[model samples]
Target: MDKTAIKKFAVEARRSLIESIRLKAATLGITADGIQAKLPISTGDVEYYVDEQGGISGHDIVKRQKLVAELKQRARKNDLATAFNDLIEEVAYTWFNRIIAIRFMEVNDYLPSRVRVLSSTENRNIPDILVNVRDVEEALGGFTASEKAIITRAEDTELPKDRDAEYQMLFIKQANALNKNLPYLFETTNDYAELLFTPSYHDGVIQHLITDISEDDFNVAVGGQVEIIGWLYQYYNTEPKNTVISMPKSHKFRDTEIASATQIFTPDWIVKYMVQNSLGKYWIKHLLAVGSLQNESEIAREFNWQYYMPDAKQPDNVQSKIETMDSSLKELEIKQLKMIDPSMGSGHILIYAFDVLMQIYESEGYSRREASESIIKHNLNGLDIDTRAFQLSYFAVMMKARQYNRRALTKITHMNVYDIPGTDDFKLEDFEILLSQLSENSSRLLRHFLQEFTFGNELGSLILEYSSSLTSLREELDALNHNQLSFELIPLLDKVADILNSVELLGQKYQVVITNPPYMGSSRMESHLLKFAKKNYPNSKADLFAMFIERWNKALVSGGYNAMVTMQSWMFLSSFEKMRVNLLGNYTISNLMHMENNVMGIAFGTAVTIVRDYQLPSFIGTYHQIKTADVSGKIPQHLPIADNRFNRTNQANFAKIPG
Candidate 1:
């Protein structure tokens, strides 16, 4: 909850983790230049390299080959420098994520072992899991077969032991054990860590993480929130953001750096305001449509919402237009209502929306556990370009679900959160060859669908133009699943099936589409992204945020709410004139709060705007123009004072004013 402290720890953590991981990589004889040393761990026919800590058997030798292949392939993809640094940063951040997750689990007593993995309950410095591994009975978490073998070796008296090496091996075993539960954070054969998890790192980086941050920061009983991970993620990107800015003007943000350059954490208050007005307002409208709730103020009070503005008295025409709202809300079940944050960086917006959805579900007679599962399974969806962001968001949501349901994590088979897939590595030629075997129009649709996924790392959720084709591909793939196929094609189709599910979610309609979309002007866009926006979104091609404003609108139904926190320049800049005209012509704003510069560490002025997907040209919308600069902790305090300065106007009125 302490932003200053979280930021300080995160910025420093990034530097320390990167340096530590790099040092560990160096010890392993892998460097940006090339692999300088190889310990031949021969397994019959294949030549394999031994790791730094050595003494690993056949499985590790095979995994080490995987790691080497990935590194060499990446170096071929870009330069050696880019690939090396990216691999190091990725591994470092992943470990950072794992440490944070373990601490949270330990504090919450959510670990199945009922043991603290990172720090001892009796002593802050000692890892209880490490100590626990010394005794076979202390391994209450239940280790895998390989891990038990390692444990048996650790207990061997004749084996000469280095305590540091012992601890390193034990911690890796614990990480591997946790992998079955948390595959998202730690894949069983984690390519990044397979070759890099060295004895040097445990002696250096792991201790630094445990000792550096305050214990209370990870303890929920002491006022910590799982949302601290979001702050840490934002802070971690500070250096990358600065690096992007320091680049030459013509330099474009490549795939690896795009997320880092554009992710800005939405302040909680702003997120609440956006969600309260969009999804919150949608539920109220549903209640009104079905005559379940009439008085908006009474509903707001019942919900205990600080930012939900009860609608003001409307003119007769505006009131009549409102009366024509979708009464079909009464026909649909609450679970049918879907909401997504397409640019869900660390899922800050979706996290708040989860709480709101929980209240809505419980009000309708669902238990907390049932409602939590339903929210994750049915109501909430998220998408992001950054895999790291996706993982953090996934962890945050899963942790939140675990807060309500004891068995939520294990029971979850799939979540709607997806990092948009890129087509660069896609085996399209093979899929196409399989498709040539008497497929329906699926082959054509599959081609179009895969084509749309191109540049996904750069364009991300903005790749909405092919949603129709993606849906068709889904149907065809579903049909194909029932039929017998070639063994090779079956595996290939299985991969496509997974991607199909995610892309279909990306393209589907939602009742509420909310996000603080990535903000970068057209001038800064990489050539591929710039070209895509120009071709697909010419009207709103001025900035990435503006393009998202247009894109998410397509992701919503007619009566859905499209809400976002974004740079305020879209409201006035000449470059955005066409975009404004398009919005005014198609949608009606319900609420707009224009804030002064540096509102959320953004230098430019910004606004939180909520617009109805339907057109109500005559409807007067609430607009709060707050000039207070950097209202960091003071937003809620300023709202009441801001009310007197607010204006009610039809957004169409903006068209009459000069650009």
Candidate 2:
């Protein structure tokens, strides 16, 4: 669309997203006052500014003024990425306020109470739900003073002993259900209109459930359960929106480190080509398993069997699960991959994984169901401390998953694998039993169990028998999976998930570990997060990117691959001595593709390097110099597996001009 149209659309969409978030907050009881100081909704923000001379000003003039002001404020800061994270703090603050509100309502009332008009921030249900209850209570205005006290207690305190928790859950669900479906319930996107008009439905239902139930039935909502409401709101509000806000075009600017002037946003076709090539073997296996599936219907049947009915299939249910298993194996051979961009503005690396995994699935002939599960479960993973990057990653996953299952578009919220089997150290009495043994050796058993998880080990039919042994803990386990487990699961899962998640980083030896990590110099790393990293990763030098490399490489088994589009200066910059030694000592440096300009039209030049984990006899630390390929032209030696040595460098300077 035209520029003005783009601005108009962006402004409207951002406003809608913000407003929807605010209204959702209101439903959970966070009043304007609770969030006003933190996130004041901008009402009269200008769309465009005019010069005093009466002429409309160009975007450049406005953008320059803003940038200069920002630059001055950030003059002492070396890390641009850090400045961006400040915005993340604000966004997260707003999100948590809504979370607290939901918790209060959910904890305070299982059944809807008589609606009392509350001041903003009083932690009550939305005015809509309360308005109807208020009207009903008013109609029966002759209640004794004692009854009013009972109503007041009901509104603010824990439920009486006579309430059924299940009914309360249902009531809360119903209340939330309406809030979630507000757009459809009332034919309007106007935020206040939905809040003003929607309370009557909850009035009768809440009154009936609370007054009738017995006391022994109350239960609390699970942690992260409120996330469901947020997920649903996004689903109900689904629409594809895109817009580009204009900023002043850059004048001559040197990357403070690159020391050279170059335009940014280097085309990534080469890096993409190489990664896809490396992923070829993984893709082929995904293709074979999918080929066995008879059709989409068969695939869908298998999917239903796997997720909704994990036990429904007999031993013969290999039709679809086999395809999934095979793909997982091939992907495993690639080693549970985690690609990061240190200077990750948007999560291009993660999105690229999405494309790569999808291709492998499509190649195998699996339906979208199989493809999506494979991508989400097996292949793609990444991390960026950048909150915007985190959101970008999340949004990208939702969009990609939508391709396979439209319903998934609504269901998947956090892109991080929030819950996986061993992620939160699943304490089966079996594990404690195994670990607690003092006989000739419990180490062997622990090793065996762990080995089974690693190196593609499967306990097979034995898992059924062993899993059955844990029946006594079924209720607890069920609660754990549902995110309702005891506080005990937290520290346990943190440890377990950390170890398991770390495995994805360690198991395969990378032939390449590629990235453009955030280019913060050592002087700028200070905040709590940076301090924690320093304390934890003290000996190992870690910038956002370097730490990513360390963790990823540690996860690599051997002979694995690494490739990255990162800041060019990191190659020879003085501060990176430790990183340089780690690279040269351990990896076979085969290629470095230096971009004269930027990677994201931001002010950093990029270098794409291909490194092999194990050095071949003739190729250690050598620059196999090659000509830059045209983006639209034939893909270059993409995977870098072919046997060719164009140049040898026992030690070469990257900063000095390449002859």
Candidate 3:
């Protein structure tokens, strides 16, 4: 499959689907004009509708009630466009779900026996409800007349006097049920279930959309789906407020828009570079610690120290430096070493990290199955604010693991990946009430929990305990500690416990942290997000990506590695001088590959910088500046890192600069 062509096709198909939904909505009297009459057209509401308490006013509530009443009146009169718009969202969601299911089944052989069997009638015992009768009969054998009836009932057909509505309802219900069993492929809740139905989109049109992409040519089955969906999401945001009937004018850009507009599908080579330089470098250090290298030449070859240290005149100094560094990693330690991508869109970084970690595990005599499980359970962690991205990332990781362990999907072990906590659920008052119940000493401790939790291994122990427990913290407290104070503090303790579990997945310190963090300027950020950044990342608040560099630094263990491809403006921009100073003060840059413009198929100038999160005062870092004329639109997959094209720079002097 030509990825570019697939991407274009997917985008167009999505737009067509949305346009159809809009036209359908208009026909049913759910036009934008009707909606605007009840609710004022404000762009601020478009951006802040989900923030509820943050932006919604008393007047907004009255308007919402009026809009609901108007919609209800239309429904009573048999006008269904309001409902149709909702169905459009659901249909789009279901379409993506179906694609993911088909691709996953195609790639993995060892599905549950119940799922693999081809029963024509609705099989309650099987979770593969989306697989229609034709699919099952073709894969297995012929279906009986009774089976054909069941299959036809499940499908949307005009031949039976327009059963599209019934088919849509049945399809959504089955999809939701299927989601319940496949936790790896779906989140805990199907948020779109209520809104989704079998779309009015013709079966032939849907089939044509699927056929447009040649799935075999893609590197990963889910990659094309993610790219297309992400692009469509961006396209949806750019549409005129009047064109999209589902959202109010004030709510023009949804949360997913932030991801859709900013997410760039990272090239494979960039992923490799970031992973090998950071994760690979640390493993080499571990090997050197165990005296695995027999001689100087072997050490050079094994460590690829020559790649980073091209100007080293004396092998003895480099070897001596390696000997002095600490690398007390046991085989178990190496297996469990955590790595994360904070802005893990579609899990490209985490997927690549899985490969590197697998190699490390295999070297220590682990079978591919053992390594696959170990990596998912202990090594890889990812977090994305986008729910769609989270779904794709989670699915991609499981698919990769299934390649190694055929029975991986049989037992749906939850991976460490998660969508960041949303504003609706995470409230400050809840924590405040818990804090008020605690004694002064306990209150003080709560204030510094994020920092203190990393030191005493308390977080790890809590995670293990919580993992095995069936009861919530309130129940645990009620059963074990009957004291009034303990009872009052249960809610706070439960929140803290949940935080610890999240920390376990997104470690306080990891062996490696790699990502292409979302790139959005402060001006583009929502007001609340901008305020949060100012308070949390004072120096790097100008750009979200810069803030992530600071965050990755804090998330790394001493001597841990951090690698990222970000805008190069921070390197020379005067506004980022403090950020640069703070970064150099805390970490040692290993190497930097700077590209001026139109590199990586984007117009923006970018740089790939690899650094270790430890202060090595005497360390010298390598720097390469790729001239604008030397590059075309895309960075070559085989770009050399060890060549003499890079200029060696001393860390001390680089750190001395104010800009």
Candidate 4:
């Protein structure tokens, strides 16, 4: 699981990718100034491109046409400089992810075609697909005639004869062919991303990606392949993160910048601790409530959840409140339980939650195959503002499912990981003119729902101001059918309906809300984001991570476990006194681990907490504090040696301190 090599490769690959994609775009007549995709005329059947300024002399006009259309569509959204940079960044990451994904699949023998895309089995220097381009149909399981034509046309004498051009065309077709098998990671409409997939096996990113990194790093039997995706993502953004850090205090952090600057990958042990305590504790309590099991210690040993903290002693009067909480879980089904990691970052927490869920399903007598699909479809849910994280999360979860069910990838399982949708340009008058048929009240609600999502991408899953009204609007839309509406309204109605559907999911309550939310202080926040935080979370608005404490608590069901590893400042800072008071007065700290400086490499001091949604003022909560610094950063291993740091504390006593 050592990521030294992966980290080194990822950072180098990012810089090389941006430079390569920029050079490729320049050749396509696309630059920061403008694009001149069309030439003076088409002499007979063949057409000419601006070449360097934007020219194409290829036989196929469709690829050129598609490339121009995608470029124009992206440019319309922002200034030329930002738009070009964004386009380059987007394509670079898409190709990088595809390269890594293909390598992992090829090494694990998970590719549907059983073809090594990046390198050859017979000759490692050449690509396997290139060697057998015309003879891969049988190997591809079920290749279509059109797919064959695409491969053949890539080698047409009229097209460029260069080896790099040839390899790029074949590689793109290979990635596109994989769309049917892995539609989540390999999208069809992202042809713009395809337009810039320039790196090849002969040189550039792919060269080092394969030769520099060991094959064992990608093999599932080696036990760290999937987790490598997370490390790669974190490392790839190293430059952006550094840029953000060096910016002046006056600089406003945009949505995209906010993501890169604040994201810190949680250690594996912390993820396990959060999931085992919340989900594991829930299942154990359920077993006890229903009379299926008695002692949780025995089950904890059997499950090997080393981080599952046993429930601490509670006062006599408060014991019944605990009983009442467990009473509702006596007959709940395994599929009915739900957990959400709101800031889901690469989905490390959700993936561990997936494994714990499988164990729970196994204990309930459900087969591994059945549990795999159910855990993915029902139990595990994730959300992140970054599309890259969402893609990796979806792929990682599906890969995990594939381990249990051989046909999992081919089954079209609807993954729950979502990229927070951003607001797009649209006139309210368009909705009004089209939706004149609907009731005025319903129309108004839909309009406001759209307005609420204006900063959905910037604010992310914390945008909960209009959930109740959005729910009402969803109900209204659900009652109406498209057949009853005019054709123009039908399109608007569909868009509105999809927005409502997404918001409904984002707004749903969960039994466990576990995540390592973004950590940006109010001082560094963008103007709009800081304003929103002050308006929404007036008490916990000093830092992004602390604000999430209130935001996610709202999403948690009463008595549900809301676990997180955040900065320990809120517990003792005078500036956060109001937030601390609100937290202590309202919720019960079921468990807390105060890991001070140097623990887990978070120098600012960190705390892991499992806060029950409702208060048990008299309850004695479990607490673990690490006083001495440990550069090794092995939390679970160091926990035992820090035994003297363990103690029990009643959160209610915190209010007694003098102001």
Best by lDDT: 4
TM for every model, in the order presented, reads: 0.90, 0.42, 0.70, 0.90
Best-to-worst order by TM-score is: 1, 4, 3, 2
Q: Order the candidate numbers by lDDT, best to worst.
A: 4, 1, 3, 2
Taken over the whole model, the C-alpha lDDT of each candidate is 0.75, 0.37, 0.57, 0.77
Error of 3 at 415 (Å): 0.5
List model 4 lDDT by residue over 454-571, tens digit each: 6667888778834465555656676776577665566567557546655766778888989998888898986788889999898898998899888888787777899999988888
Q: Which tens-of-lDDT digit does each residue in 114-148 have in candidate 2?
A: 23222112534433333243443422333456545
Candidate 3 per-residue C-alpha lDDT over 1-659 given as tens digits, one digit per residue, 9 for 90 to 100: 36566555655656665666555443323454444322233353331332223233344444444444535533442345644444455445435545545434432332332343211124232224244434434333344575456556656453443344434433443344445435644432233222222343234224434345554433244543223333333333344322433344344333444655567777666777778777877776676567785433454355333333332332465445635655545342676588888778778778777877877788789999988988988888887765556677887777678767876765546788866533222344546766554556655545445333322211121111112232333243335442654543554565465454454455456888898887766766655566566887888888878887887777777778889899998898877889988888878888788977776667788998888876765566777777655555544545555355776666788756546
- Quote the lDDT for 268 in model 1: 78
| Candidate 1 lowest-lDDT run of ten | 47-56
Q: Which segments of candidate 2 are over 4 A away from where they belong?
A: 1-274, 277-346, 386-388, 404-516, 527-543, 620-659
Roughly what TM-score does model 3 have, to 2 decimal places?
Answer: 0.70
RMSD of each: 3.5, 19.4, 10.4, 3.7
